[model samples]
Target chain A: MALDIPSPAALQLTASPAAVSAALTTTQVRVTSSFRGARIVLYGAVFDPSTTPSDVVVIVRGPDLPVRIARKTKVAGVWVNSRPVVFRGAPGFYMTASTRPLADIAGFGTLRRLGAGIDHLAINAPLEQHTETRYGVRDVVVSRLGADYLDWRRAVVRLKENAGLYDADDKGVTFVDKDLFKAEIDLPTEAPTGRYQAEIILFQDGQPVSRKVRSLTVEKAGIERTLYLFAHRSPWLYGLVSMALALGAGWAASLAFRRN
Target chain B: MDLYLPIAEVSVNAPLLVALGALVGFISGLFGIGGGFLMTPVLVLMGIPPAVAVASMANHVAASSTSSVISYTRKRAVDFRMGGVLAAGGVAGAIVGVEVFRWLRLMGQADLVVALSYLVFLGVIGGLMLVESLQSILRRRSGQPPKPRKDRRPPWLYSLPLKMRFPRSRLYISVIPPVLLGVFVGVLSAVMGVGGGFVLVPAMVYILRMPAGVVVGTSLFQIIITTSLTGVLQAGRNQTVDIVLATLLLVGGVLGAQLGAKASSRFRAEELRALLALIVLLVGLRMGLGLFFTPDEPFILMTGMG
Candidate 1:
């Protein structure tokens, strides 16, 4: 057993598996009328036996969408939304889980580069300008308003976390053995319907060795899907249908109660 | 059990929603008010988006009002001519009101304005009703004749042109007053996210001098048209109406309204008014305190903005 321990150089020299093979408890999250939330289990086995001095980090990113946050200020004895910050390309849901604490596993720069944390997400401010030159101007503005923009960005993260749409857990993943590990992601009821990407990164000595990406679909099913489609596709008809239903219900209720 | 609201994009407890509807419907039936003001705030508190809350309340009000209107009509209490005139003006006022609402929203002061307005209106109305009802109750208990309210129309109302006769109300008043009154209620309904029945009932009793028997049915008729218009416009413009939510509320609301109507006959008029006044005061005070109290979170987020 002592002789089986390879030297550090030999360990580095050996060819590792290109990527980890992973499977999800369920690939598709079907949002039925009674859906509250779901706990998805992701299990994977590191192919290389020599991948001991490594960590596994799983990142689940939901679809990107624009989000707006407003800060309330006391004005004339009342609270009102005064400053609004709009964020573009913000994920509707985001979660990161790691076998060990993210800070202990990797440096800030590495985590940022990998976009493995909520703070490291690539979100942009929607600076209103149409012209191509606006990018340069916006960059200058952002630099000048760096502190304010950072506060707004942090607020966005805080809001999403509060809403259960963004989360991170250092101990969310556990290694069953040297070769197998599992991560659990809890999807909240507010999870938007869209394509989600689950990325599993294998890290060796705070460096990425291999990575695997899996596509997951979160979709409204059954009547939920039909109603959503009807509202979005033909809003006028949807409105009329809603009105007719309301009227019919009212009439029926009146008739039913008349006898009593 | 939990049910998902498609437009609101939130899952809520089904029984809780139904109970909320029942409570508000009972209040509406007892008071002859649409209960939108109460319902909207409650929905917002339940984590539903404000826009969705307001739009769906309109749908619920339309249904509830329709049911009440049918009952009132069967009893020959509705003055159709008066309702028609008010509804016509309401339509035009609602158009103008929508524009005003948009303008206020652009300035980001809509929420403040709505809250302040509700506080003021509810406070004043509730206070007045409380005092009058209490006095009436005391007078009746003491075996004294209740003082009669002055029924004389204002001079300005008499001088106005386009006079019309409301045979059921037994009034020959200027149509302009009712139309203008309708416009005022319409604007309030649009801006306040209510059916304006609380305001309408008082206005009809005092300003238009409509008989108490005719007020509930007539106001309900107007509410049906006005709130239905609001529901359609909200759906068309904002796409905020959640039919699933509205349906749940309507189911509970219709049944609750019937039961409340039955219960109303059992209570004395003054006692009913006093109870309603207490509820209004409580709601108003809660809203007023919200304005002064520091919020747990000074920052709020509005998602899905493009």
Candidate 2:
């Protein structure tokens, strides 16, 4: 059956594919869904729908955004949302959009963008770190930003890395029993104010079957901001203050009991 | 040492503390001894941080003692007048103990000294008590009338001046022994993480020849002084005194103590003494065994005034 699928409407060809991928490295991809082939997914910013691919199929991808991500609709039984999908590798590779849902099942997918599209990767099963069954997967692809888009950088998606976004020692996550396992990471004082994309990939026989792309955040709390106001430039002092507070509170409680 | 339990932070773990407190309180009530004799050592054995264990035990002691003491006082089982004199001495001893603790800490010998002293004291005193009670049983079995000493004080304790009368105990003798014993128990209080009642009660009965009526109250009075000081000192130094931990033990101890006191009334005095002896023997064996054949060094052997 023929369907009037959504595709990019005001499409244009300014720069060649090679030049577009080179110029728009990571954060310089425009969302234009032009359905010419068996269209699968569309990668674009949520702000401009006109740039989003339609006529075939569309799925908003890429995280590292400034605001909230909302749910759009479902293809089958799985929930699809207007969010960022990150593929950790170079940009400028052809991604074929599959017309049919992955596994024709409820909760799994392997999607990619067509021409002028961003790269995509998928995983198998979910993992919960608390349990003993742990899983991990890794895949990278080059994506292209349309010539007219502002900037699209070569988005790198490593299956595992530490995140300082949580103001911990590391970033990203590992799949443990279908749950997420994030190690500690350090957060720089001048880090950007946006959501970073990190996906938990599950592998079966070295190939991804199930996947979950998560948006991580980096922001200062009120108390953290107040402390930063004076010594906002020093991360070392900020860490010291946090340790001091934990220790001080413990000491004060003991003192109060001792007095009574 | 990773010795401290994170339960002090979690609200869900409160029940464990309470249950432990109640069980220990019941045993303490039954045996007529402060649970610290068992608890402090048990916590230490179970790998609790010494500072937290001792401070927490002290808080537990205060709660447990008050639990039983209140009921004993209401029932006219506690003799306040006699308790007052011992408390006077106890206060003085506690002050000296605190000073000694500071001096020992400065010398970097507090841990070893406290532990060693407890090991020696428990070994010697517990052994002596066991021997005496066993001998008494043997004499009874032999069907011989027990040879009794004349009803007169030993010359040294009797000869001292400042002989004062204790109305409740009805004794007129020197106050020196009780005071000295008070001092000794007080020093022990800090070192051992006990309320000092175990030492105070026995010393009163044997050394001072105090009437039974006065024993519990006097020991309780001494405990109040020593433990209160201990609480403050530990908090000031180690900052391990968790109010939440203390509060849980107190609630459980109070309720358990009340129930224990009622249960005590149902048993005869002779039966109670027999049961107390068995408990004393058991605790003494547990401590004594810790001293000799055990590979893991009894930590008590390395503490206070040693």
Candidate 3:
């Protein structure tokens, strides 16, 4: 089913093909015993035949969770973590891919409004709303600390990027023809298991004409899944079982070595 | 072959992990000490998270120590009464240690504290052992009689109450020393993610005046209990113990310990102590250097701590 909506720009927006406007090659990611990483291919066709697709940007984001970014400073001849910034809702995994450079496709204001890039993500600290305290940073008012806030935010992005959980690739998306485009997204081995959302935005004349969002489930499967569930669900039992296994293994090893 | 760790949530090479376990196990067997000090660092270097590395290494230590304990028991080398008293104190220390560990983690100083403690402890213990062993070796080579050990037991140890007899170790010292020693080792085991046998062995030899033959077995018995406790607590509290990873390491470690125990009989005691001292000193030096060196990345991102 296609949804045709009129944009404020008075442009007709439609996501097609109606049956499957945007689809992921696999809706589920299974983490088995030998799982290293996985690749996801997202493909779709823009239905606005009247106007050629100027830009296609695909954004994939993993489940959001609280994250803490810390900067280390040398203290008393040892490096110690200082000045920690805690983000209340940070994506565990994020990637942005586009047909061309994002700056070349649309203006910064439009891109930020659409939340199409890392800089536009709505991540905030716990005390962001309080003007007096401003996220536990001592004596720094929120209105006066714009530059410091940007620095902390940039630090978050830089650290996450180094951790292989956040990425951006301007050349990741390619157009097969006039209307069909595809993007490849990589899920690193350390990626957290959760629901991931992929949004395909069709831009014409540097304006977003249509957008389609699809979700994929990434979860552990088989023995991996069972173990993870057991550990989280009944941690006491898991601990007991682990201890018993360790004890038994040691005993068995002793017996085996004694024979030799 | 690649194997996925359920708890750590990472895939790693199975054989490489096993090889690392074997290498550490051989050293433990040859030196009569738990190998956690070496194993934990190697696992962290192999891209495993530091928390997971510490927890899983505890499990590996428990298993390896058990195997050695069995062998030592068969040879009548273990002082069970002393081990029991030490373990009793160790359990209490481990409980307190876990709380301290949690507090340090909240303050974001867990890594720094653990690393610093490791460097200081290893440096002092390794340096002392090296000098003592070298002196003994030189005396033998020069055809001089070995110097008599001084009555170095502190005055406080003699005055403590609750004295007990340990016939196996030929000591009638107060039980307070062994118990307090166990408590100190337990704290080290929890915070530094080591079995604490490195500290225990030297303490028993120099302070408690236990026979060298009995020290190894008694230390292994205490290690088995304390590390097992640490592993269980870490699994329950932090969910950081990776069972699959521990199993791979244990498999190789058990075999290597057997070979190491066999080779232990071949080397002279002074030479073995000297070699162990060198290894400990090297590890300490490396960690100590880390404190002074500037890291390539000054920023780090952590999850599940907000």
Candidate 4:
């Protein structure tokens, strides 16, 4: 629960001299055995605020992990999973917060390129690679499955959303002062351990003027970390230990009963 | 309080998990059953991944059976020789079962297969037990002596090769039948994350014609080895066993089992069997209903399969 804010790195000055920088309340999150969930605040300031009104968009994304979406179909009398679609680089956690609606802040092309909105988010998958130019970038996401692929994509989002992993809020980013703003992102207990990225973008005139990226680490700590490493690193030994523990406990219980 | 399971990677209520373990353990002790069939499904219902629930329950079974085996050993009820043969066959079955489990997981049918297995086995076993127990209860109520069970083994059992003499059970049976029985039970243990005692005990009494005195002990002896082996393989190969979760269950199970054992003397055997049968049938029916009913969410999402 302790917050350790690391000094924010200055971003490159854009042509307009407007630079947006952000820092998380904690640069690292240690998920202990008692970890339920955590709320992290990404606070930053936009320097040299222009006379023209601008919007701030904050995105916090977890590490890419492969996910499979299996659709169930009736087989005989029981329903069973049939076709499965695998997304190779689905973010384990994704939260997007903006001062205003992303569509109103920037054009579709800009948001798609930035991957700012939930709908505009691009998840990588193994698909036929005939690319079409869209939003000044080759869109590899649109594949032979075509419109059908969107169903699978939507399934992933819906499931993640239900799990409280993927989240979006049009007005989650609040400006506390003339240039100081903060965005809160909630990390669920089921969030995967890995590196997370927080990106703060300043949009003006329907275009992103300045962007800054900050990295955060979420990892198992204390007994949780040790056990996770032991289980994965030397599973055979761990298994033996598990057997031994069971045997010992069973023997102890029997002895206790006998003594009584 | 919520505690995160390292391997399962999910936060769950610590007290709730312990209570679940205690409940399963108490039932197992009261009925002299392994309780894996009950434990696995309940864990899954509590949102533990199916694979983790199954693998971890194997470890729990190992502990519970060990407790029973120790008591049986003190009373000279266990047939170590018979248990060894069964264990050998069980180990072989477990090896094959784990591989099949892995393949099912890859095909994304592990959950379906597990549910079906539980539904079928629990249903058949529960129904048979209910009918048999009810008949016995009625006979006792009418002051009629129960019909004596036929002690004769099937002719086919004697016709098998590699016959062995088991002085403990005072039976001369073919080694092949016992070994094959062991193998079948072992596969069940591995795939279903059960102790397989429910099946093993009945098979030994009727098919092998083992003495009723040695049946429970011999089954427990086999269960300990098979479930321990299954636990190890599951942990090493599938990495599905959650040691922390296993430990919590053990703490509650050991204590609950001792209390249940103490309480068992007060209950009538026939009545207990009938109650156990009813509980089993209810769990089985619940699982079966899940299969037949349409899910609100037709899509199942899995992460970290890459």
Q: Which ten residues in a row are the worst by lDDT in model 1 chain B?
A: B297-306
Q: Judge candidate 3 against the unseen true structure and give its global Cα lDDT, from 0 to 1.
A: 0.82
* Ten-residue region with minimum lDDT total, candidate 2 chain B: B297-306
By lDDT: ranked, best first: 4, 3, 1, 2
Candidate 2, residue B120: the lDDT equals 62
Instruction: Return the clash pairs for model 1, or none.
Output: none
When 3 and 4 are scored with DockQ, the better candidate is 4
Clash numbers, per candidate? 0, 70, 0, 0
TM-score of each: 0.92, 0.50, 0.93, 0.93
Off by over 4 Å in 3: A1-20, A51-53, A133-147, B151-153
Q: Per-prediction DockQ, in order?
A: 0.56, 0.02, 0.65, 0.68
TM-score of chain B of 3: 0.96
Q: Candidates 1 and 4: which is better by DockQ?
A: 4
Predicted candidate 1 versus true structure: per-residue lDDT over A1-260, tens digit per residue? 01111123322322565457788899999998988989999999887655367788998889887786677878787777865566776888899999888889988987776777887787767563233336456434333235566777787888889999999999988999877899998999999888888888878778776777788999999999999889888877887889888878888888998876
Tell me candidate 3's fraction of native contacts, as a decimal between 0 and 1.
0.73
Question: Candidate 2, residues B7-105: lDDT per residue as tens digits?
Answer: 121122456667777777776666566677667766656445455566666667766666566556655767566666666776676666766766655
lDDT of 2 by residue, A1-260 (tens): 11111232212222222110001113221111111111111121111113322112212222222211121233343222322222222211112122223232112322232111232333211221122322443332213322311221221211111111111111122222222122222222223323333332222222232333333443334432343332324433432343233223323433343355
Find the candidate with the highest DockQ and give its number: 4
Better of 2 and 4 by DockQ: 4
Instruction: Please report, in order, the local distance difference test score of every candidate based on alpha carbons.
Output: 0.82, 0.46, 0.82, 0.83
